[model samples]
Target: MDKQAALHHFKEHHFTPLLESELDKLEAKFHRCQAGLISDFKQSFRDLCAYILSMQQQGLKEPIGYIHYSFLRTQMLEQSYLYMVEAYSAEWYEDDSDCKLTYDASWAYAPMSAMLENLEQQRKIYMGAINSADVERLILESAPFFHSFVDSLVRLAIAESVQSPEYQAIHKAERLLIRTGEYRDISENLYVWDQEPLRADEVFEQLMQSSEEEPYVYENLKSLSLPHLHQFQKDLRYNDFSYSDLRGSQFHTCILLGTRWQQANVEGGSFQGCLLSDTDFRYCHLKGVNFSEASGRVDRENGLRTPGLCGIRFEHANLDEADFTNVHSFEHAYFEGASMQGTRVPRIYQQHWKLSDSQRESIVWTE
Candidate 1:
């Protein structure tokens, strides 16, 4: 469905009604306990706990559900702190000569404290999953949920007191909404690298034209399909090309120090005679790539050598005919694929230092 239709469906059917109901119940309880009496406060705390538990059970089934639930829980916990602060007033704490007397303090503080801690922990868990998740997937699947979540918060904040602790919760909710909105924007206009609006040759020319002291660095080029890029041999150090498609590209004798190629598609790319020290190739498709004579280790001015293959990963790629001879730390590189047939590889001793069984079997020994 379209964005508006999907958002309307989610808001009307799932996110809006649920959040409004929970917030309404919490607000009603807060209003009833305005006098700050311990009994009334305890009841409100119990109500909050019930809502939290209910959301945990029902609103964490999917990625969108978890994101919505986290946003709401954080807001709820922030509001709950208002009751705790009110409970800790002079009436609750009595200072005697020998000790301080506490009255119904645990009833007002304990549950909310526990719930806040749980809320933070759950938020972390959800955020970790969200970070690892595909941005496009999240935008397509969770955008409606995020939209309704932010809308619910905005509606709730209409009558909320700014000086009150509940306002802090609203502020936090707004920050989260803004972050999600930014993600949505990115998803809406994700660059099509295959379109080649930003060509490697053009970029190289631009870099050559610039007089910056540091080597040119490009970042956030995810999902760019820049195929068949040739003549990339330049000072392209410290560049981030993660999650881009560079299929069948050529990088003959390139200096790729500290470059990040994580999750990039470098299928059939050539990197022959390249300087690849400190380059990250984790989760990349390096099928048939030429790395022969590539210097994975570099001599530094501090009389020490940079690690040769500290973080190279070829976990699940077609390595047929990919050259690895004279590539330092070939032994340290991960190669968890099928056995090499006619591929040129480092010697058995060079491959033995840290090679796994599958990696050992995957290499064809050359002298």
Candidate 2:
């Protein structure tokens, strides 16, 4: 069409509102699409970059371990673009009414979708290139886009494997084992300084000092692991002890949810009256611990699953009225005076239990 005819059409159709509306629609689509893919994508990327640079600055001479790199890579490909476009498209169509406007909107979004998908591909390639040195340079150079990718990948890695043993171990060892960044003892909760071990007496003193109004301690307990604490204890109130020490330390009536005790020592630690639901004790020693009074007192606000007392030598451990609905026990696990109502014991033991006087007295073989 000629300019005059187009101008005439514009006048006839009141194109100003339509143009503004289209522009608004396009801008809104871009924002939504971007937002769906990332929250403050640029800022998150910068943070990721800073994290990487900080790691590199630490001058880590040891070779890094191989991670499931493809997991993060595939996640980026799927999340960084695909579902975002589809989600945003549905959102846009839900509001769009006019056919012409809808057509225009579709066109506008089409280019963006294609562009974003390509951008997502590029992100995959870039992040796939991310290794020890490349990750270091991307972080050091402060590449905003790279930062975005790195940030997403880091988060993705955390999200995907947060519950796995490797992730837990890495997290527990993040600070102490991290080759990046200089060690800073800003908070007693994050670092386990060999030079500044919290002595048993000091721990008791700290626990008893209720009147001094102890200062708030913000420790990055992300890497704080205590897989073998023969007798580690600290005041457990509003303190982030996600990976704190619990090795032979007796935790009494303390609230410890979301605390990281992965592979930490809890051997002989009396957890009487302590709230310890959902706290990781994987691969940790729990032999002969006094959990008789501590079984049912777990903090349930965090929605963690009931923990298994299996592998932890509960020899003569009083578990009266304790909920062992899913706890696995070996044949030798003693249950003298232990409640078996709804407590799952091995099937083989179930037959052997029939021969016992208690089973004979408890069971009535009536036709």
Winning model by TM-score? 1
RMSD of 2: 20.4
- Model 2 per-residue lDDT tens digits across residues 44-142: 333433433344346421112211111112223222321111101112224232111000112222332333333334333333432233322322222
Deviation in Å, model 1, residue 271 alpha carbon: 0.7
RMSD of each: 24.1, 20.4
Tell me, by lDDT, which candidate is best. 1
**How well is each residue in 143-212 modelled by candidate 1, as lDDT tens digits?**
2322332222221221122223432222121111111122213311111122123555565455555333
Model 2 off-target regions past 4 Å? Answer: 1-51, 54-204, 210-248, 295-367
